[model samples]
Every structure is written in structure tokens, then in C-alpha cells.
Target: MTQIIRTSADLRDRVAAWKRSGILVGVVPTMGALHDGHMSLVREARKQSDRVIVTIFVNPMQFNNASDLDKYPRDEAHDLAMLEAEGVDVLFAPGVNEVYPDGFATKVSVSGISEPLEGAFRPGHFDGVATVVSKLFGMTQAGRAFFGEKDWQQLQVVRRLVEDLNIPIRIIGCPTIREPDGLAMSSRNVRLSEAERAQAPALHRIMTAAAEQIRAGAPIETALEQAKAEILAAGFHDIEYLEVRSVEGLRPMETFSEPGRMLVAAYLGDVRLIDNIAV
Candidate 1:
């Protein structure tokens, strides 16, 4: 059974006791639509630490669109069952007021790396991510934190946050978990229509193919342009971006002289899907 701690003060006390006993803590932060992708992170946390705390708060601060926030999936009972099966120590599912209480005026912002890709398409998104993630770090006081590499840019922003702010926690990035057909698992996947769901896997399939081309010395722009056209033709409604960038700084890569990543954001109807691959 997992202990459900709904407030920061309670979580701190629990963490304090764990630390007093010299138990290493690990945390997996998420919004509550638990799927295999999220479970993979929990399993890693469990293996790497003495205790694990999985936080599930749909942070409203991160949403640029009010309707998108409202539509975000959440199921506490189902999520709890999954956490229990994973033997998670705590489910830090706090309310909005609990995380951002009255008079809470602070915000955590990481610039540069956060200004492109998802950040450009979704404004003020990473600020909410940084703010909530920093608060979670402080609240959990865990020695290690696990994040999925599916959100590669997000992993970078968080790594930068911990380094710049000197927060004492190790950030571990696990590989992106995908379905057999190759669609990356996401909470938003639930919103896709039956037809859209079938078309969604093409994002990964096409991105992977483009990445291989870039590696084989195809002109970066030509490869990306073809990928975008193919994705739109493959039944996607629109493409936000299909770009090759440096894995470190996320700077646009023209020649692929260094290690790069192929990242794409395409829409299958109103549900925008994002995926990335190594190049």
C-alpha cells in the first residue's frame, strides 16, 4: 500500500524521518494519468533508492490554454492502484492551493534551452515546470530524481535548473518508452480519436527514418522538409516543427557535425503529439 501525502509539510516530515534513518529517497514527478511509461520511471526509482515518492499534481501554472488544462486526464483510484503495485512509498498528490498557497509569489524560470521547441509552441510552460519541479525537490528532499528521455528538452531544462540553482539532487533520465507500433506514450494520447490513434505512430516511424537519413549524410534541411511533408500526408492536421538540433544546447544543426537529436511536434487533429529520436 502507498501512503498518500497531500501536503508539503506532511511530505517533509516523512522525508525527514527517512533521512534521519539514512535511507536514500527517490522521486518520480507526474500528472495522474499513469501508464507504462510512468511506471517505468517508478520501477527505476524503486531500484535506485531505498524509498520512492511519486508526485501526481496537474499543475495549472504550466498550461497556456485553459481548456487544455481542464481536459488533462486524471484518475486517482487507478493511479493509486498502479503505485501500490510498484510499491511506491508515497503518492504526493497535492491540491493546487497546497502547492501554491495564498501569498505564494515565487516562480522558477530557466531560459535559453527552454525557449525553443515545446517552449516556443507552448508559452510559459517551462516556467511552470521549473517552479513546480523546484518545489517538489524541496518538498521531497530526495537524493535522486528520475525523468523520461521522451521529453528530452525538458530533461535538459531540469538538469540546467538543478545545476544553476545548486539543488543537491541527482537527475537520472531513462529512455523513452514506446508502444509496439512506435508511438511514444503520453497522457494526452487518450484524447486521440480512433483514426488519429492509428495515424499517430507515423510520427515516430517517420522521425526515426529521418534521423537515419541525417546520420547517413542527407542534407539536414532536406531530410527535415521531407519528414514534415510525409507526416502531414500521413493524416496529421499540422506540424509545429520537425527539426534537428544539438542534443546539448538544442541549437539548430545545419550540418550534423556533432551528435544531434531529431525532434518533431505534429498535430493529429487537436491533439498535438511530440516525439524525438537520436541522430
Candidate 2:
């Protein structure tokens, strides 16, 4: 039976017992509304470690829009049931006050790579990401942590945090799990209206095609400009960015001499979708 832990002391006690027994631990951090994409991480953790801890906290600090934060999907009972089926050892579902209580004053900020992309569009986003993630690292204290590559830039930011802060856990990035039509799986996808959902796969489709053309010798700027046009034509509004960038720093790339990535974020009606592909 999977254990449901809601307090840091209870979690640390369980972790201590696992430590004493020399069992390796892996943790998957999530904001609930469990889906197959989140399960993929749990499965990977199960495969690699003796114990798996799945955290279900919708970190309020990360949302740029207060309404967006309020609307973020959360179904903990469903999430817990899914984890139980996956053989997760513990479900760390802490209250917001537990994670960020009164007198909480510290924030973790990673400069440079985080300043662009999502950071540029969603101000203070990565600071929230870095802060809560750093706290997760401390709270779970697992030997390994799993993150999905769908949030490619976020992965780099976490990796930088682990290295720069000398955090002991190994950050393992799993390949993005996508829907049959290629829409990247996200908790927010649940809010997409049916019409928006049908049109959502185009984001991935366009990015994939753009990456192929760029790889096949198309000019980088031209490929990106065409992608923006395609997204706009597809009825996406508030198109935040569509550019090819160096995978490491997210710096825009004009020449595709080395491996690079094409990242995009646009709104399909009210739902914002982001996707990336290799070039």
C-alpha cells in the first residue's frame, strides 16, 4: 500500500527508514491532476530506485497570473489513486502553508538561461520554479529526481541549480510523453476547450516541420518567421515566442551548424501551449 504523507516530519521519518535500509529513493515532483505524462516519470523512478516518492503540490509561487493560479487543475484523490496503482511508496501532498508558511522570505533565482523564453514572457516564473524546486530537493532528499523534457528550459534551470548549489541529487530528464496527435501532455491541457484541443496538435506539428526544414539547410531566421506565421494562421493569439535557440543557454541561433532547439509558446484561445523540437 502506498503511504500518504502530508508533513515534512512524516516524510523525513519515512525517508530515514529507507536510508537505514540502504534502499535507493527517487522522487517525481508534480502539481497534481495526474496524467500519463506524470506517470511516465513515476514509472521511470520505479524502474531506477527501490522507493518512489511522488509530490503533488501546486506551487502558487510559479503562476504569473492569479486567475491562472486559481484555475490550475488539482485532484489529489485521483492523483493518489493513480500513484497507488503505480506502486509509489509515498505521496507527499503538503498544504501550501506547509511548503510556504508565514515568514517565508527566501527565493531561489537562476539568472541568464532563465531570463529568456518563459522567463521573459512570464515574469518571476522561474524564481517561483527555482524556489519551490529547491525546497522539494530539500524536503524529499531523494537520491534521484525525475523531470520531463517537455519543459526543456526548466530542465536546464534545475540542472544548473543542482550543479551550482552542489545539491547531491541526480537530476534525470525523461523524454516528453505526448498524446497520440503529438500535443505535449500538460496539466493545463485540461482547461482547453474542445475546439482549442482539436487545434492544439498543430503547435507540435509546425515545430516538428520547422525543425526538419532548418536541419535540411533552410535559413534559421526564415524558418522561425514562417513558424510564427503558421501559428498565427492556426488561430493562436498572444504568440509569445517562436525561435531556434542553443539548447544550453536558450540563446537564439542564426546558423544551425550545431545541435539547436526550436521552442514556441502561443495561445489557442485562452489556453497557452508550448512545444520544442531538435534542429
Which tens-of-lDDT digit does each residue in 19-87 have in candidate 2?
A: 999989999999899899999999999999999999999898999999888988988888888999999
Clashes in candidate 1: how many? 0
Report, for every candidate in turn, its global Cα lDDT versus the true structure: 0.93, 0.90
**Which model scores highest in TM-score?**
1
How many residue pairs clash in each candidate at the backbone level? 0, 0
Off by over 4 Å in 2: none
TM-score of each: 0.99, 0.98
Predicted structure with the largest lDDT when compared to the true one: 1
Clash list (residue pairs), candidate 1? none
